[model samples]
Target: MTRFRAAPVLRALVTLAVLGSVAACGTGTDAVVQGGTFDFVTPGGKTEIFYDPPSERGTIGNISGPDLMVDGKTTSLSDFAGQPVVVNLWGQWCGPCRGEADDLETVYENTKDLGVAFLGINVKDPQQDKAQDFVTDNNVSYPSVYDPAMRTLTALGGKFPTSVIPSTLVLDREHRVAAVFLKALLAEDLQPVVERVAREQ
Candidate 1:
């Protein structure tokens, strides 16, 4: 598989953000990126819940990479097969990511008993130590795939926005996308949606 570098995409998005042309979180304006089978609903940093039935929902399939916290080891979405997963995309340098890290851990601990798993995809930060330190500092217990190149975003088949840091995706038991959050979020905002998705199937 060809690894896709994230610098170009992130740089472009950063420029847009600086220009005020890109809407940050809480803006609430809906922007849909239609590509292939998945309809990526990026609502100005808000969440987009897929109400379609499980079979009709889109899946990103299996994505794997080196384990950020464990050297010589790898992690993959398929590791949590048959279970619901909360996939978070974050970079250590991102302020929003740092702010939301604790909240993500909170939700993970709260729902792990229900067979809900949380996975973080460490992106953009090429330095492994920085990303690992962020996880350590935040007391994040969940496993993260170290993908500095953001190659896993390519696994989404061009449907997901690689530029969106602090993004979250809640997957159902079938590994289909159930909800998508394009910005930083707290446990209060994430917990309920997770519980609801966990209840399905």
Candidate 2:
């Protein structure tokens, strides 16, 4: 089996973030990458994991649903409880998001009614109109919560620290996170995990 390598999308996001941090903090490479050690061994040694949040807090996938708005309406992760929810974090300016938009939409089209839900958290995007336009251009019919303020994102970080853009979290039927992909993806990268989670009792 192929271990999931850090794809170009993940590398790009990390590079952009490092550049921004370097500009903002005037720090060297080591300074920007902070925090202490974290040890997590993926199940079966597969890098792109099938995981559950380890505790009630201080880790990824341990939080409950966040309330947000899309197209002037309100919704939350909890609303889709008892169903697998594909939560994708993206932004309009992100090249990888644009590259992966169709893949997300394709999987969404295929599995929407099979007790699966797809939600987009459009964060760090300054213009809501342009973000909506991207969805339209991609023929992505799924509703995405516009999060210019990143309120939902801030909440996510407080609960689960993997707040990288162009990331995806596959929440199992019980609303627990089943898997997380910290990179842009093809439909193939997504469908297997989604199908597996959907099969959960």
Give the number of the best model, judged by TM-score: 1
- Candidate 2, residue 93: Cα displacement in angstroms equals 0.4
Per-residue accuracy of model 1 over 1-201 as CA lDDT, tens digit each: 223667778888899887784455423221111233445654565455554677778877577777888876768788898899999999999999999988999999999999999988888887989998898889999998888778777655565778879889898888788888888999999999899889986
Winning model by lDDT: 1
The residue ranges of model 1 lying beyond 4 angstroms of the native Cα positions read 1-49
Q: For model 1, name the residue pairs that clash.
A: none
Task: Note each model's CA RMSD in angstroms.
Answer: 13.6, 16.1
Deviation (Å) of 3 in candidate 2: 76
Residue lDDT tens for model 2, 74-133:
555555767788988888899999999999998988888788998887777677678878
Give lDDT per model, in order.
Answer: 0.80, 0.66
Off by over 4 Å in 2: 1-47, 52-71, 155-163
Pairs of colliding residues, candidate 2: none
